[model samples]
Target: MGFFNMLLSLAAKGAVILFFLLLLAFLGYCLYIKRIHMKYDHIPGPPRHSFFLGHSPTFLQVMKEGKIIHDKFREWSEEYGPVYRTNVLHFVFICVTCPEATKEILMSPKYPKDKFLYKRLFNLFGQRFLGNGLVTAVDHDLWYKQRRIMDPAFSSLYLRGLMGTFNERAEKLMNKLSDIADSGTEAKMLHLVNCVTLDVIAKIAFGVDLDLLTNKSPFPEAIETCLKGMVFYIRDTLFEFNPKNRPFINEVKEACRLLRTTGARWIQDRKTAMQNGEDVPKDILTQIIKAASKEENMSKEDDEFMLDNFVTFFIAGQETTANQLGFCIMELARHPEILEKAKKEVDDVIGMKQEITYDDLGQLIYLSQVLKEVLRIYPTAPGTSRDVVEDMVIDGIHVPGGCTAFFSSYVTGRMEKFFKDPLTFDPERFHPDAPKPYYCYFPFALGPRSCLGQNFAQMEAKVVMAKLIQRFDFTLLPGETFEVLDTGTLRPKSGVLCSVRHRKYSK
Candidate 1:
């Protein structure tokens, strides 16, 4: 009895000691985070919401409200000047909207991606999500190598070949919309657009056809869930500990597993075909595998990293373009005069044409301007962050090394200093005679790390829009809220609810 009591006493004492030690370590961590914030004291920004919580709550609120983060950013920039600071917990992010600073930061390879932010993307919920993919690769050398290998897949020749896939998938969507148009049923343009883009990427990139339009595929829903999961994992501090979030976290993990499994199956099939000495389709996966072989010091984990890119390109190639198309339709439905001009341009250029060729896309000039204008107002992936490796002066503000600098295409695109009547959706702003918005207008981003698929996305968008305009007249459904939802990537909150009908042609 005596010995048992003594053992219990010792265990109780150990627990107390360990708890106090943990308390001290947390205090130390808080102090270290505080010192980092002190370095940016010279910079102007909104006052932190709390000494302990910082600006994280405000950020969460903005996200939950379904308004674009850039809206709040614009307000802050007007009050705090072009360059300002914001904090989430211990990390301080300085947002620079000055055109010169934007150019210098984006154009230079010296400023690599912010390691802290990109690293989060590397592992979501302790699973490797975007591991060293071109978008998330922090090491500049590795990124350059990866970029070089993937360049051919996105080259002009390759993209021109993809025009057929784009048009074919787009035709499938128009057929689906035609059914809805005939029935006078409301369609969520974003959902259908997402289906078409997903099908296009699957067929073109992987040589696999996902008939998402015919059958309701779970892939789109899984990707959407994963995107929402990213926001939850990134923001919610007690994500793992909270029982309420466990189901959601599990769903995200399963989604990741599903994607990786699909990628593995696709990869294995390609390898089998190659080993059998049989003819195999030349696709993005084939190109990626070949690229990996050519890379010096290629590790056995090369295939795993390729899966990283599979998920990256799959999500990247589809979501942003779909969201952009949805927003373009919404804006067109709201503005009838602008819609008629675009419709007329499409009719004059395309006129019920069966194939939208590369030359035909070029001739749809007004439609091109309209697409550019849509991105100007609503860039899907709004901003990019860079790590300041060296001390630099940005717009007369001396920012220290180890600080994160953020540049928002959305915020910059909407600024009065960059665009006249910034809130207005004027396609005329992109007229050939009009001066370009310079550094302010980057829908696909700028510099060496700029979206390699910019031309590809633009082509895809033009084809989809041309067809939609050629076939149907769309009207926004009543009680639909036209707002942007940022679940990692910006998309329409209501999924762009609209009713479509076949256009009435004069005899």
Candidate 2:
């Protein structure tokens, strides 16, 4: 009885000390947030939805409403001006639509990626999704090193060699569409495009044949679940508490695990091949593995880091291009005259050629412009964010340090000041004689941190679109809405449903 009483007394004393320590920390945090709030007092934003939640409630509502977050940002920008602040809890994020501000922020790598967002990708849904890959790496020096090593994989020569693979995968899509067109059935172009892109990336990047065109690969649904979960995780702070979201949360976790596990197996096979002196194809896996092996601080963890790149390249290389192609088809179907013009260009350049050559790509300038216009309006990965570690003045506004600045391509693309009749699908905006959009359009982003696979994606898009336009005439299915869906990447809400018939002139 005496010993038990002594133990209880000691536990009480420890609890009292712990409570006081927490109290001190809470007080310190309050003071810090107060200082941050005062610094941005001049900037205008929506009134706090709650004293405790700030604007987070409204932000969450925007996300949950199946509305693109950037659309909401654009709406708010009209009321609050080009530069407006948003608060989520105590955190202040500045949304910038000003071209000058965007140019300054994106042109340099000094503004590191905001950790609050990027760090979530490092381990989301209690599973490592992107990990510390090139896209999610927060450390500037580390990302730079990885970028340098991976540059060769995306170099002009390397990409040119992959043209054959691009044509091959795109041909599979053409065959599938031909079958659909023969059946007189309306098809979801986005779904078929997704299949082609998935098959292309798997083959070219990893030397793995997914055959998504003929076979229903599990990767697409897995990728969709993972992406949806990530977007959910980003917006919903109380997501875990919702009983309804539990099953979905579990599915996302499993999807992430499946992706990482598949990546690990592929990486191991490559490593084993290298060890056995077997001939391995020159692909992204080979390139990054060489890079990983050369790291000065090589450890098991460093080797595992290559898996990050594997997952990153697979999703990044495929998803954005597929979304872009789907939107391009949707727009062309909507505007038949523009489609006819594009078809003329394709017919003139391709001339009954089944295979698209590198030289053939440049001559398809009109088609290229249409693709560019598509990107301008429907940038799949809409915007990017930066961590302003140091206080900086953007357009005469003093934005303090330790804040996040969001630059949106979607918001900037739609502004009437930048693009006249911004909502209209006009490919002529990218006509050769017209002036270039200065510092305002970046579908694949801009600067030193721009997407490495820009050339690869555009090249692949051109080949697929060239073959598509060369062979088929598309019509959007009736009652199909063209609403943009924001599942991390912006895709057509109705999946670009369309019926197709073989072109009369096609050989």
Candidate 3:
């Protein structure tokens, strides 16, 4: 009885000690958060919702209300001026929309991509997504090495060579759309364009012919699932932990696995072909493999890196261009006058031309302006961020070091100060005679880290869009607003639904 009493006493003492230890840890964490708040308190932002949550609650509210988060950022910019601070829990972001800040942060190599943000992209639902890929690589030397190797694939000569593939893939889309046009069925322009871009990237970048428009494929759905997952996963820190989100999180993991496994199989096939001395096209996959071949002995990490580039190219190479094309079509359909004007230009430039040549793309000047305006209004990629490692004065605002600098083309592009009557979808904003936007317009982003596939993407977009306008007259289906969906990348909420009729001249 005496020994039993002693044991109970000792157990009670241990419980007390554990409680005190936890209390100290919690207190320490609170102090750290307080210090961070104090550090950036001088910066302007909306009032915090709570001591612990910071602006997270407000952000969640915006998401819950089904509004594009960047639009909210633009509103905050209007209220607080161009440079302001926003916090989500302990993470702080300095939003900069002015031209000077944009030029300094993006033009200079001094600011690298934020590791905090990009590293989150390195995985999705516990599956490796873009691990150490060119897009997610935060290391300067590592990214530079990969960039140098891949530059040849995106060079002018290489892109010019890809026009045939671009036209072929886009022609397939035209055929599919023609079928729908005959049936008088409303077509989802976003899905159709997505298939075309997917096919183009598969053929030109990886030397695979998915022919997604002709054949049903899981790739399109998988890409959509992964993109949707990315938005939720990256924004909400506790998203994966929620019991209700488990199903979606599982689907995301499976989608990621599908992409990576497909990449693995394709990569292995290329390796076997190379070993057997079979002829293979020099493509982005070739560059990806070559980027690693220089190493004496390839490691598992190196292999994963190759797959990373595979997934990155497949997603990044296709999604933005597809989204842009969808938006362009939607805008053209809205303004009949603009549609007629653009169609006339396409007729003049590419009339009865089944195969659009590289030279033809350059001659479609008005079409180019329309495409540029689409990007300005709806940059599918939306924004880029940088890690500010040193304190600097941006537009005379003293920003502290160790904060993220966010530059959103979507926010700046819509601001009235940057573009006159920014809400108006004016293609003339990109007219040849108009003065170029100074440091304010960057749909493909700007600087060394700017999209390497910008030219490739635009070339594909022009071909598909010009052909679309040349062959068919489309009208937007009624009852859908011009709402944008932000699923990692921005896309039309209504999928750019349109009814098409074949033009007599083309027939």
Q: Which is the leading candidate under lDDT?
A: 3
Ranking by lDDT: 3, 2, 1
State every prediction's TM-score relative to the real structure: 0.95, 0.95, 0.96
Give the C-alpha lDDT of model 2. Answer: 0.87
lDDT of 2 by residue, 263-380 (tens): 8999899889998999998887898778767767767766666788888888988999999999999999999899999999998999788989988998999999999999999999
| Model 2: how far residue 101 lies from native, Å | 1.6
Compared with the true structure, model 3 gives a TM-score of: 0.96
lDDT of 1 at 74: 85
Among residues 3 or more apart in sequence or in different chains, the pairs in candidate 2 whose N, CA or C atoms overlap within 3 Å are: none
Name the regions of candidate 3 deviating beyond 4 angstroms: 1-11, 295-298
State the displacement of the C-alpha of residue 454, model 2, in Å, after optimal TM-score superposition: 0.8
Displacement of the residue 282 alpha carbon in candidate 2, Å: 2.4
In order, candidate lDDTs are: 0.86, 0.87, 0.89
- Those runs of model 1 whose alpha carbons end farther than 4 Å from true positions after fitting are 1-20
Q: Write the per-residue lDDT of candidate 3 for residues 352-450, one digit (tens) a residue.
A: 879999999999998899999998899999999999999999877899999999999999999999999998999999899999998888988899999
